[model samples]
Target: MAPIQFQVGEKYFTANTKTLTEGSAWFKSLFSGSDKLVLKEDGTIFIDRDGDLFAIVLRYLRSQKVPVFYNKIYGHNHLLYDQLLTEARFYQISYLVYYLENRFYAGYVASVKVEILGLDHGVDVPLPDRDDDTDVQYYPQWCRKEVYVCPRRVAVHRGNPGGCGRECRAAQGDRPLEYEDEWVLKTTEIRTQTILKHNMDSVKP
Candidate 1:
């Protein structure tokens, strides 16, 4: 058939049925069974999306590789990144989700650190070394003790990306990600207090 026209914002991009169906199941359903698509007199479908960002998505669709613009976007444009994510989900493109998550994780890990509670001390899980270490976040002396990390097991069980919440498994020791640290300690402390309170009541009587 003819090239399917998409009007993103004030601009337009063209795609064919084959390319749309190959990348997105949502598109597959939309094109195959929907009469709701508003087609121009020239038979082009008008899609309401940000043309600039949708252009990036289309590039990824055409070429399996993410555009080099991703490098410029990393660590700089959280807003655009989030917008792109919204667009990706709207289109039901799994590859876009995977690419964004993985790419974002690189910047995320550099700026965030995960800490595990130890019996006598806190074990700091260092992030991957980067050439430019300026943006890597370090814990303040006071906040160091307050920062507790979620283990991979718990995050994965909760459907966090990479089976570890925040893609933090690289820092954990060889243990299941669910192994609780600070939160578990707090719960245990509360439970112990309750038991102690009961014992004290019995003794007082």
Candidate 2:
């Protein structure tokens, strides 16, 4: 059978009827038997949609596979994926729509790094332990109190000398504190991270 010719936007595309019908319910109804499809004067059916994205849809229909839309330097081509998603929904391609939506949620964090700036030892405070049922308690004599330098706040952690039985409690301040010799200093860093699930591989086609 002759391929169906389509003129979408300012581009042209050609696909066999079998591939189109199998990929989209919209296409299946459009090409259903005995119904004559109107065509432009040049014999190509004109579609009021993006031609470039339609080409990607056609390729997926033919191969049942999609290329990885990622770049090392510029990161994932989110714009392209968004465009393809719109095209797939317009075409009523259920599988393609599912695939693209899953890909959107399949982001993974490639790497992470942390840096330590400075350290200071603060004045030791001695307290008697008559522990109430609180989540944290510090033993007497050997307990060390440390203040953390944060971006906009300070956090104080009270722990035993051996770094055990430590509880981190946030201490809000007007501004970031500088490293001081009298204060046992640690840096508190807050970072936003994206965690990838182990089942991410299931989304692969």
Top candidate when judged by lDDT against the true structure: 2
| Window of ten residues with lowest summed lDDT in model 2 | 131-140
Total clashes for model 1: 2
The digit string of per-residue lDDT tens for model 1 on 1-205 reads 8786677678888888888778876788788878657677787677777888888778767765543222321434656767887887888888777666555323323233233332322444445344332223332232122323355335334423344433566656586444222322221110000001111110100
For model 1, the stretches where C-alpha displacement exceeds 4 angstroms are: 68-76, 102-205
Runs with alpha carbons beyond 4 Å of true place in candidate 2: 33-38, 104-205
Cα deviation in Å at residue 196, candidate 2? Answer: 16
TM-score of each: 0.45, 0.49
The global C-alpha lDDT for each of the candidates, from Candidate 1 onward, is: 0.54, 0.59
lDDT, candidate 1, residue 104? 36
